[model samples]
Target: MKNTYKVNNPATGEFISEIEMNTKEEINLALKKGHNAFRKWSQVNAHERSDLLKKWMDNIQAHKAEIAELMTRENGKPIKESLGEVDYASSYIAWYAEEAKRTYGRTIPSHNESKRIVVTKQPVGLVAAITPWNFPAAMMTRKAAPALAAGCTFIVKPAEDTPLTTIRLIELAHEVGIPVDAIQYVIGEGKEIGEIFTNSEFVRKITFTGSTPVGKTLLKNSSDTIKHVTMELGGHAPLIIAEDADLDFAVSQTIASKFRNAGQTCVCANRILVHENVMDEFANKLTTEVTKLKVGNGLEEGVDIGPIINEKGYTKIIAQVNDAISKGAEVLVGNEYNANHQINTYFVYPTVLKNVQLDMKITQEETFGPVAPLISFKELEEAIEIANSTPYGLAAYFFTNNYKTGIFLHERLNFGIVGWNDGAPSAAHVPFGGMKESGLGREGGTEGIEPYLETKYLSIGDL
Candidate 1:
C-alpha cells in the first residue's frame, strides 16, 4: 500500500532512509531479466562460478565494519553480534564457493545388459527467496550463495523492517563481478511481491524464512505452479539441563544461547527445562548474570541488550510476560515494565521467569524478545516429553555429563539440530533446518545447495 519503505534505527526510533517500493510491473520486469540471465549463467562452468563467489566473499570481509554497522542500525542487534553475523554470513559464500565444485554426479549400473545409467545435477532455474529481519545478512547469503554457486539466478524480497542490510550485501555481490540481474532484490509490501514471485512461471523454486503461518501461505500459493519450495519457519527451541550436568558450564551456555541478539534468534533457547534438583542454583546464577546485562542502543559501547524490533514486538513480549506471571510463574529477574526500566517504547527488560508452567503463553508460543522462561522437570523422560510437546522441532539443547544420557537425549530430541553441552551450535559448514512445522528444507552444509538443483537421470542404450 505504501509507496516507500522507511528504514529506521529500531534502538532509538530514529529515521534512517527511505527506499522506493518496487511495483508489480517492475517486479515482473526483474523476473524476466532474471529468467534471461539464468539461461547463460547456468551454462557457466562450476569452477568459474566458484571463483566469482570467492570474490564476493572477499568483498564482504573487506567491508565488514560498514556492513555490520548497517545491520545493527536496521536490525537492532548489538554491534558485537552484528559483526559476528557478518562473519557468519560471509562463511556461507566462502563455503558454497568451494562446494560449487563438488556437485558430484554418480553412475548406476543398469539392470539391462547393454545400458548405462547416470545421474547429474543441474540448476533448478530462477529462484525467489523471502528472508526475515532477525538475521538479515546471514539469511540472505545462506540462500543466495548456494543458489548462485549452483548456477541459479536469485531474486529476494527482504523484510520491510530490515531491507538495508540485504541491499548492501547485494551491492557487494555486484562489486565483485556478480551479474546484477543474476542476483537482485525487491523491497515492497510482502503480500504483493510474494504473490508475484509465487505466480510467475519463471520462478522455478521458492525459499522462505519467517513464521509458520506465512510459510503456509507461500506454500499454498506456489502449489499452482508446482514450484520447488524451501520453508525455514518458526522454532520453539527447548534447552534441557540434566541432573548430572556441570552447573557452571550449563549456566554459561544458557546465557550464550538465551541472551544473544536479546533473545531474538529462531534457535535461541525459548524454554529452559531445568532438573528440579538444581533448579534454585541454576535460577539464581542465571538471574545474577541477566542483571549485569546493560540494555541500551546497540551502537553504544558495553550494551548487551538492544531494543525490540518495533512496537508490535514489544507488545507481544509484554503480553506473554504478563500471561506467564498471572499463571503463577515466579520472576527470578526482570519483570518490571515501567518507564524507569524501559529506555524507550520498544526496549524490553531482560526477563527470566522461574516455575514457568507449560500452559503459559511464553512456553507455548515463540517469544521473540529478551525473555527466558524456566520449566522444571523431574526425570529425563519427562524433560524429553516436555521438549517434544510443541509442534516445532527446529533445535533442542541439553547439558549432560553422562554419556548414556547425552546419547539418549540426542537420539530422542526429534529436532534438526541438537546441542550437547553447547549453546551456540550453528555454523556455516553444517546443515541447518528444522523438522515438522519448524521447516521444510536444509540450509548450509552440502545439503544447502541441493534445493537449488534438480537431478536428471540419463540412460544410454547399447553403450
Candidate 2:
C-alpha cells in the first residue's frame, strides 16, 4: 500500500518512469546505517578525508556531460545551466576538501596561571540533507561536500521530480571511497522522509532548501529532538536602479539575473524599483531585452528560457500575470502566447510589466517565472522602503554611481546578500543564505562547514 510517483520531462510533458516510495522501516534502516558509519567515519584522518573528497570531485568532473544531461532531461533547465551547475557542485567539493584541512580550533588565555582552556570541533553526527529540484546537482553536492568533509554521514532526499542527478552523484561517491552507508539516497515523498528525519534520534542535523512553509514545518519537527538545522528558503529579491546609473548595464544585468533558469532562481529580482526620473527609459530597455530571449526546449541550442516545471507552476504564473494586467499594470512585452506552438501548455511567455503597484500579486509574491514587474521610486529612501517591504529578505541588487548612495543603500537594505550594480553575487567561496522569513543558517564559503560541526571545550588544571 506504499505510494509511488512518476517523473516527467517538463518540456515535452512526457512520462519518464515511476519511483516507489521508501517505507518507514526502510528509512529507519538507512538512518541506523548512517549512525553506525558516523562512528567510524568521524575517526578518519582529516588529510585522508580531504584526499577522498578530491577523488569524488575528480570523478564528478570526469562525467560532467552525463550529469548535466540527466539534470536537464529531468528538471527542464537549459543544458548550459545544467553544465554550469555540475561544475559549481564539483567546485564546492574541491573548496570543502581544502577547507577540511583548516577546521582549526583555538586555545584561550586563562586568568589562572595553572589553567589551560582549549576548544575543538567535531562532526555533528548523522545528517538529513533535503534539497529542492531547482539546482538538482549543485544543491545536493553543496550540502553533501561539507557533511562528508566534517565526517558526518547523511541521507540525501532530493525532490521527487529531480532525483536522477543526485542518485548518480551518490553512485560516484561510493566509487570514490565514500562508504555506502556514509552517503545514502532516498527518492520518495518529502513528508515520509522528513518524518523519518524529525522522529529519528540518530539524525543530529537537518539541512533543507525549499519553500518557506515547508521550512517552517521542518523547524518545528526538529525542535522535538532539538536537532541542528540550516534552511535556505524562498526569496523576493528587489533590483533598484538609480537615476544616475548606466541604463544599459542595469537592464542587461536584471535580464540575466531574473531570467536565468527561467526566473526559477531563489535570488532572482522579483521586484524592480527604478528612479522616477529614468523609469520610462529603464522599462523600454528591459522590454527590448525580454523580446530578444528565446523560449523552447532546454536541450535545443539558443533556447534562452525553458518550460515551467509542471501544470501547477504554469497555472500560477499565468494567473499572477493576468491579475497584474487586470490591475492596470502595463505590459510592454510578452503578455500573449502562441497557441499554435505545440508545447505551449508547458511554456509561459516571458513577461515584462511596468506601472506595477505594491498591491499587485506579482509584486507581493515570488513570481518564480520569467516575469518582470517594474515599480518607480523618486528617492533613495523610497527605493529602500519598497525593497524591504517583503517579509522575505534573501537578496537585493541596486545600481548607483555615487559612492555615498552605494554605502547608504548597502547599510539599509534588509537582505542577507547585496549585489551592487551586479545581479549574481554568489560563489562557492562566499557564504549564501537569507535573513528574516527567507530561512535560517548559511551554506558555502568558510562558514559552509560550520553547520556540520559542533564545538567542544577542554579545560585543564594543575593536579
Candidate 3:
C-alpha cells in the first residue's frame, strides 16, 4: 500500500534512495505492453536477439564498478564479492547470446511413408520472474538472459531488499537498443505483484528463485492458467570431508563455500560431515580459519564477512546457533554476539561448532549465516547417509583422494549438483537447480533456455 520503497545500505544502515512502487493499474498496463512486445519480439530472428543481448552484456561490464558498489550497499556483500557477482552475472548474458543461435529443433522420422514430422522450439511468450536478494544481479541475468535469448519478453519483481541492482540491469538492457516493453521491472509488495503475475493469462511462464514454501504457493497460484513455471528454490547443501581428503585443501574449500556472502547463499555448506579419522584436525583448522576472518562493513578494505541482510536474518541466525548450543553442540569458536559492536547490529560473527549432533537445529535448517557445524561420522556410508538425510537436495560436496570413493559419492548424492573435490560448482555454463522439495527446473548451460521455450510438433501430409 505504500507508494515509495526505501533502499538502504545494509552494511552501514545508511539511507540510499526511495523507489516508486508500481500501482496495480500500472502493472496491468505493463503486462499488456509486455504481451504486445512479445508478439513482435518473438518474431525477430535469433541472431538479432543475440546481438542485442551481447550489447547489453557489454554495457553491464562497462558500468561494473557502479553496479557492484550499489550491489554491495543494498545486498550486504563485500565489494570484491559484488564485483565478482557482476562478472558472474554478465557471463550469463554472454553465454546466452551465443547459445541463442543453437536452439536447434529436430526432424523426427515418420512411420507413414506419405507423412513428415518436425518439431520446433518457440518462445513461450511473456515471462515473469521473482528473484531473490542474495545474488541479485546474477539471479536476474541467469533467468533473463536465457529467456530473452529464447525470444521471450520479460518482466521481473526483484526482492524488496535489493531492487536497485535489478533496476540498473534493466536500464542497461534498455540503453543497449533493447525495447523497454520487451524487458521491464516493477517494484512493490512481493505478494501483491506475484499474484498479478501468477493470475495473469498473458504471462505464459513464471520463473522464481526463493524459498520452497513460496515456490509452492506460486505453483498453486499459477495452476488456474496452467502457466509454464521454473522454480529454483531453497537449498540445505552438505559438505562431506572423507578420511583421505587433504586437510588443508578441504578447509580452504569449506571456507570458500561456507562464508561467501557471509553464508547467505542457497548453496552454502549448511551441514558439514567429517570422518572421525580427521574430525579433530578438520574442526581445529576450520575454527582457526573462521577466527581469522574479518567481519565488518562490506565496503571496508579486507572485510571478508559483512552484516546480515536485516534484523529478521540476524535473529534467525542467532536462534539457530543458540538452539544448537542448547542441544549439546560444543562451540569451537564465535558463539559470542557483541551487542555493543559499533559497526552494525546485524553483524554476526563467523561461528564454528564441534560435536554437532544430527538432531540439532543447525543441521535440520538452512543456516543462512556464517556458522559451520561439524558432525562426525565414522564411515563413508555414514557420512553419505547424514548428508542425504535432509529434504533439500540442491547441492552436495565431498572431498576424497580415492577416485572410487569420489565416483561413489557423486552418483549416490541426491542433488542437482555434486562437487567431488570442489566447493563452488555453479556457473553460467552448468545446469543449476535442486531436487525433491528444493524446487523444479534447471537454469544455465544448454538446459537454461529450455524453460522459456515451447515445443511444437508439426506433421505434413502427402509429402
lDDT of each residue in 164-213, candidate 2, tens digit only: 88899999999998899999988778987888898899999999999999
- Lowest summed lDDT over 10 consecutive residues: which window, candidate 2? 336-345
User: Which of candidates 2 and 3 is the stronger one according to lDDT?
Assistant: 3
lDDT of 3 by residue, 1-463 (tens): 6599678887776888998999998999999999999989998899999999999999999999999999999988999999999999999999999999999999999999999999999999999999999999999999999999999999999999999999999999999899999999998998999999999878999999999999999999999999999999889999999989999999999999999999999998999999988999999889888889998878889999988888888888899999988999888998766442344358889999988998788899988999999999988788888888888999899999999999999888899988878998889999999999888999999999999999999999987
Off by over 4 Å in 3: 338-344
Per-residue lDDT over 142-255 for candidate 1, one digit per residue giving the tens place of the 0 to 100 score: 999999999999999999999999999999999988999999998888989889999999999999999999999999999999999999999999999999999888988998
Model 2, 14: alpha-carbon shift in Å? 2.7
Rate residue 222 of model 3 by lDDT: 97
Model 1 score (lDDT): 0.92
* Superposition error at 343 for model 2 (Å): 9.2
Give the alpha-carbon lDDT of every model.
Answer: 0.92, 0.90, 0.92
Residue 90 deviation, candidate 2, in Å? 1.1
